[model samples]
Target: MCGRNATAVYRFGRPGRVELTSAALTMAMRGFAGGGETQITAVNKDYRYTVFDRTSRTGFGEGGRHDTAMSSGLLIQRAGRTVAAKACSRDATVSAKAQAIIKPGPYVPH
Candidate 1:
């Protein structure tokens, strides 16, 4: 995950992991930071995994404070139905450059 459009691999369980190309990861992160929803699909064996993030905003401009929350997770689907779902840890932190990378755009789906 170093140079020019590399892939990032995330392991959630033994023999369970998802590999996301740089472009996909960037889009997902941008969408997540922008308080929007984004998804990336990956296939392993017979399972279809959808890694997604959903963000919600509240109290915007209220007393000069805005509250934003995001929930991220992976859903495993087989035969077009969800089989398992796992939520990412709540303690995760976004990088310091998060604000610089955000760009407004239409909803992204993959």
Candidate 2:
């Protein structure tokens, strides 16, 4: 159950705290773009999380909510599909989560 905040592997995405278990991987994204944590379970590998344009203490609860105008559920670039990861000489089951909000800003794409 021991965990600490650290930079993401190869800086592939936002930095966060990592907590590992025999059956799952937990990461709580921190800093300006951080809102909640993403948990990747071994059984499904589905990352249940909430992150967005603005910080909110209310996290993604029970996977029974919808994306608001300001926030969206987690986005994942699963392992074996990330090209930047291979170029960086890192090979592992890496998962990335990006906040998908519809707004014109650095977080959103044109």
Question: Of the candidates shown, which would achieve the greatest lDDT relative to the real structure?
Answer: 1
- CA lDDT, candidate 2, residue 80: 23
All candidates' lDDT scores? Answer: 0.52, 0.28
Question: What is the C-alpha lDDT profile of model 2 across 89-110, one tens digit per residue?
Answer: 2322223431121111222110
User: How many backbone clashes does every candidate have?
Assistant: 0, 0
Residue 44, candidate 1: how far off, in angstroms? 2.7
Off by over 4 Å in 1: 1-5, 10-12, 15-34, 91-110
Model 1 residue 18 CA deviation (Å) reads 11
Candidate 1, residues 2-110, lDDT tens digits: the string is 2222343334343355343333233344444437665555455565666666776754776867687877777777766778888888723333343244332332333
Q: Each candidate's TM vs. the true structure?
A: 0.51, 0.22
TM-score of 1: 0.51
